[model samples]
Target chain A: MKTIGLYKYLPIEHKESLLDLETDRPIPTRKDLLVEVKAISINPVDVKVRSPKENVEPSPKILGWDASGTVVEVGEDCKLFKLGDEVFYSGSITRQGTYSEYHLVDERIVGHKPKRITHAEAAALPLTTITAWEALFERLRINSDDVEGNKEKTILIIGGAGGVGSIAIQLAKWAGLNVVATASREESVAWVRKLGADEVINHYQSFTEQLTNLQIQEVDYILCLNHTEQHWESMGDVIRPQGKICSIVETEEPLNLNVLKNKSVTFVWEFMFTRSMYQTEDMIEQHLLLNNVSGLIDKGVLRSTMNQKLSPINASNLKKAHALVETGRTIGKVVLESF
Target chain B: MKTIGLYKYLPIEHKESLLDLETDRPIPTRKDLLVEVKAISINPVDVKVRSPKENVEPSPKILGWDASGTVVEVGEDCKLFKLGDEVFYSGSITRQGTYSEYHLVDERIVGHKPKRITHAEAAALPLTTITAWEALFERLRINSDDVEGNKEKTILIIGGAGGVGSIAIQLAKWAGLNVVATASREESVAWVRKLGADEVINHYQSFTEQLTNLQIQEVDYILCLNHTEQHWESMGDVIRPQGKICSIVETEEPLNLNVLKNKSVTFVWEFMFTRSMYQTEDMIEQHLLLNNVSGLIDKGVLRSTMNQKLSPINASNLKKAHALVETGRTIGKVVLESF
Candidate 1:
């Protein structure tokens, strides 16, 4: 199998940053599905993990997560998927990633792909979709089923132009919440607005001031996709008393949690890899939520977030995709299809 | 009306730490209830607020929170109570506290005193009960109604011999969860065991090591009543993936929140005064929960934690109560009754 991988972690500008090589294909085992890679997407994690580092891998390290593929084989223990099943998943961080002609993933984490969408589009959805879904419904404990109850609540999605934020805004709105999104650029603002944001505020400005100007006293919840450290105080200021805040971004510095003490607020982290990393009892929830997202996609309630596409999955294309994502300003998602 | 107050913040040993003053009785208005004070309990907040400081109050600042009294008058808008109704409450931090011959409280934050208990016993409950109940059922989102579901979960109550932890142990046990409490002193260990803790760990040592010695790997929830800064790392180490942590202590130093990111853990504050301080839409929850607690007390499902009581509420008695709480080793709540 031809795989795009790296032996050395280097800057994207370097020729040896990523290389195309032939590798023996892996076999499915114990609830695993051997998937024929169809299309893949680049996320911030891919760029971060592949960044320049001192440690060198003995073998080529595959570095991708999101994929839309067809299951070519399944282990005996696999019950959720079978041969020839078209599936989509953000494979476990601990495993060799989806940047290959073939990939192996636990069937419990894979979801049936939306039949109505192309593989390229579906590839852009899994990682961000799973993240947004869990952050809203699981971490923040939003009652997605209770639309009437959700109508009285409001959520602020910081970095609304990003991949997770784009999907989060739609899902929060679908859950009947008043969705206020943050986007600084004009195109980014328009993109979030198009995705059903009830209001758009700039992340560079004071969230409290902006919300106040918009006549929103405070938000019931906040989903922070951008810098957790930078927005910490503003989030504390604008979150309603007893409100919840969920963030996917890891902070570089310590946080003064005492800021939220008086209001009895909640701060929760939403690391999408937590389930797969820990092999938790509820790891299958990712598969379930993905299927629900697929259903929503098929029903035309959600549109694909894929904004840029590259063809012929190779080291060159992946490097380009990585470079684009590294800029940290890419709207929606960037996908590469067909090896 | 006679009140115990302080014009200056000073050491508990100072002669002027608390003073006996005569003042006009306050009248009830709006949702207020004018209660004839019967008994009061001293919490750590009273001691902290009375600690030596540079600022001096023009008028004496009254200090006390947990109280059980009779409603001498009710405001026109008050519907929860009427004249001569016996009440128990942890009044708002924003308002003057319950250290006088007569005290005023909002009806929404007041509850019917337990019929089977003495005023001092009921007085010992409100502040700690509200803190524990909110931390468990609301902040951690533990479903008290689903005993069978709760049976699989475990909670680690840090500083389990304190007022909040004493009630938390009972509440968590009643909810069917395995309760692991932290206590160093032999008396505290016995006290928490008497209050229904399934396991007792030493907070002075590594929680992970202690729980491991007890054949428990981790806890699903952590209710931190002691030093959050000191226990922050240990709490992160012993919490299960996707676990929730609720703390009532305010950290003097900033916390490295990144420790819990990989586990997708939740950190929430459980300040009992939040609803009343913010005048939140759900401020009435305090009243409703307190009444439920009163019923539980009457049914013998819960018990008061007051282990020490002082007679004839006065400046001298309050000073002694403050000193005891300042030691940070009070086994349970301390109560003062009968002005």
Candidate 2:
């Protein structure tokens, strides 16, 4: 089988940063679904794992996470999925990724692909959708079922034009929260507004000043998709007393949690790989949320975040995707098809 | 009116640390209840606020929080309590405390006293009960209504012999979670176990070592009643992926939140005074929870944690209580009756 992977982590400018390889095809086993991947999406995690590192891989290490594919084979214990079924998922970090001809994912974490969208569009939705959904409903524990309750609430989404933030703004709006999103440029600001953000603020400016100008006193929840360390203080300042904050970014410095102590704020991390990394009891929650997102997408309550596409899922196209993600200004998702 | 307070922050050993003074009696207004104080309890917060400092108060600053008394007057807007009603409450930090012969408190944070317990016992319960209740059921968001579901869950109460932990063990047991409480001494271990802790571990030793010995893998929830800075890493290690940790203890230094990122753990600060300090819209929830706690106490599902008793609330007795709390090893609560 033809696969794309890295032998050594290097800058994207280097030709050897990513390579095309011939590896033996993987097999399905123990509740696994052998996915014949059709489309792949690039995320910031791809750029991170592919960045310059001191270590070298013994074998080419696959690095993609989001994919849309067909089930070529099913493990004996798999109960939710079957061979020939179309699926979309963000595979576990601990497992081999989706940058290959055939990929294995646990059936429990895979969701049926949205029937209304293209495979490329479906690929773009999984990782961002899973992250935004979990960050909003699971980590922040917003009662999505209680629209009436959320009608009185507000959510501040940092980095609004990014893949996860775009979908998150819509989801928060759909859940009836007043959405305040941060975007630095005109295109990004307009993009988030078009995606249903009620208000927009520039990330380059003072959050309190912008919020004060917009008449938003405090937010009930904050979903941080940008640099958490940089936004930590501003978030603590704007978050309502007893409010909740969820972040996906890793911090380089220690957090003074006492800043939020007087307000009794909640701080939660939302790593999408948590379930797969820990093999948690509720690993199936990912499958459920992804399926819910798919249904919402098909029903037109949500939209796909795929913005840029390339063909032939080879090293050249993947390198382009990685470089775009590394810029940290890509508005939505970038995908590659036809592996 | 006779009142015990401090003009200057000083060590408990100082004669003027907590002085008996004559202050004007307070009047009830706008949801306030003027209570004729009967008994008051000492908590760690008292010791902290009264710790040695260079600054002096312009007027005496009263420090008591947990109190059981009879309402002598009610404001025009007060709807929850009537005059002469027996009540127990952990009043707001912003208001005058219960060290006075007459004290004013908001009606919404007060609860009907448990008929089964004495005034001293009731006084001991308010602060610890409110902290334990809010941390477990509110901050950690444990589903107290689902006993069957909670049967599969486990909660680790760090500092099991403290005032909050004594009641938390009972509440966690009532909610059907397998409770693992950390206690260092023979008496403390026996105390938590008697209060319905299913397992007791020594906090003086490595938490992982003790939990491993108990055949426990990880906890679904952790209520940190002790030093969070000291126990942060241990709590992170023993918490299940996506588990919650709530702490009332303030950290001496900034925390490295990255340790729990892989597991997507939640860290929440549980300051019992948050609602009152912020005048949050849900301040009345305290009244509701305390009433529920009162019912539980009366039904014998929970019991008061009043371990030591003193008579005639005065400067000397308060200094003694402060000294006991300053030791940081006082089991349960110390209450003084008859102001």
Candidate 3:
């Protein structure tokens, strides 16, 4: 099997940052599905994991998360998936990832790919969609079934042009929330609005002022996709009493949680890999959510976030994708297809 | 009306710390209830409000939260209680407080006094009970009806001998969760166990070790009634993946929130006054919960936490209660009856 891996942490521009390597195909075990990778997408996690760090690895480490694949083989104990079944998932962070010709994933976390979507489009949807879905519905505890209750509520999505935000806007709107998204550039602003943001504001400016100009007092929820520390105080100020705020971005500095004391607000972090990393009992929820997302996409209620695609899964294309994500300005997802 | 108030934040031992003063009786308006306070309880909030600060007030500020009284007057819109109805409540933080002979409170936050309990006992309950109830059921999202489900789960209550902890132990037990309470002193341990904690451990030691010794791996919920910053890392270690945590204690320093990332654990602050402070639509929920709590107490499902009582609510007894609370080691709650 051909795989893309890194032996050492280095900048994406470096020659050895990610390289093509030959590896033996792994056999399926209990609840495992041997998947033949068809398409893979690059995300911020890939960049963070491959960034410069001490302690070199003994073996080449695989570093992709989003993939649309086919089950080549299924373990005897697997109850959800069968051989030749098309699937899509953001593989577990603690194990080998999906940037390879073949990969193994637990059947519980894998979902059937949308029948109407292409492999590249399906691949781009899994990681970001799962993240946005779990962040809004699970972590934030938004009542997805209560459209009437949600109509009066509002959600602020930071970094609206990013992959997760593209889907988050649609999901929040689907749940009947007023969506306020932040975008710094003209194209990004238009992109987020097109994706169903009720209002789009510049992230570089004061969020409070933008909200005030729009005649909105405070948001009921905030999903921060970028620079949590930079927007911490502003989020604290603009969140309603008893409101919830969730962020996927990790902070470099400690957060002053006291700002939310008077309001009794809730702060939660959504790391998409938490269930898989901890082998939680509810890991199957990802499978359920992904399948639902697939159904919604097929039903035209949601759309894939795939914006750029490259030919053939290889080290050079993977490096290009990583470089584009490293710029921190790419809108939607960049994927590679066909090994 | 006679009142006990402080013109400046001073040491509890100071003669002028909590002064005896005469103030005009306030009239009830809107949803206000002019209650003649019969009994008042001292909570940590009283100590916090009376703590030394740099600023001096133009007028003496009253500083009590928990009170049991008879409604002497009802506002035009107040339909919950009539004149001479005995009620207990943890009044709003923004109000004039219960240290006075006559105090005004919102009808929504008040509950009918338990017929089975004395005024002092009822006074000891409202503040702590409200905090614990909101922290467990609302913030932690514990299902009150899922007794069988809760039987398999565990909740670790930090500071189990404190006012909120005393009520939290009883409420957690009522919910059918195995309650692991942290208490240092022998008497405090006995007190928590008597309050229905399934097990007792010292908060000063490693909580993980205590749980491991008891053959427990992690807790499903954590209600932190004490210092959040001190026990944060320990709470992170013991919280199960996808578990929920709620706290009433304010952190003095910035918290390292990344500790809960791997488990996707939720941390929420439960300030009982939040709904009333914001005049939230769900403010009626407080009235409902308190009425339910009153029923539980009358049915002998929950017990009052008043361990000490003083007669005739005045400057001297309030000063004594303040001094005891300032020690930071008071068990249960202390109440003062009548004026």
Fraction of true inter-chain Cα contacts (below 8 Å) kept per model?
0.95, 0.90, 0.77
Off by over 4 Å in 1: none
Model 2 C-alpha lDDT per residue in residues A1-339, reported as the tens digit of each score:
989988888999899999999999888889999999999999998888878998989988999999999999988899998779999999998888889999999988999999999999999988888899999998998989899999899899999999899889988988888899999999988899999999999987888899999988999999999888899899989999999999999998998889899999999999999999988879999999988988998999999888899999999999999999999999989999997
Q: Which candidate is the best by lDDT?
A: 1
Off by over 4 Å in 3: none
Worst 10 residues of 3 chain A by lDDT: A51-60
Predicted candidate 1 versus true structure: per-residue lDDT over A1-339, tens digit per residue: 989999999999899999999999998889999999999999999999998999999999999999999999999899998799999999999999999999999988899999999999999999999999999999999999999999999999999989999899999988999999999999999999999999999999999889999999999999999999999999999999999999999999998999999999999999999999999999999999999999999999998999999999999999999999999999999999999
DockQ-based class of model 2: high
For candidate 2, the per-residue lDDT at B181 reads: 93
Best by TM-score: 1
Give the runs in model 2 whose Cα sits over 4 Å from its true position. Answer: none
Candidate 1: lDDT of B287? 97
* lDDT tens per residue, model 1, B32-109: 999998999999999988889999999879999989999998889999898889999999998899999999999999
Q: What TM-score applies to chain A of candidate 2?
A: 0.99
Candidate 2 chain A weakest lDDT stretch, 10 residues: A42-51
lDDT of 3 by residue, A1-339 (tens): 999998999888999999999998999999999999999999999999999887688988999999998999988899998878999999899998898899999989899999999999999988899899999999999989999999999999999999999999999999999999999998899899899999999888998999999999999999999999899999999999999999998888888888888788888888889988888888999999999999998999998899999989999999999999999999999999999
Chain A TM-score for model 1, please? 0.99
Arranged by TM-score with the best first, the candidates are 1, 3, 2
The alpha-carbon deviation from the true structure for residue B285 of candidate 2, after best TM-score superposition, in angstroms, is: 1.2
Docking class of 1: high
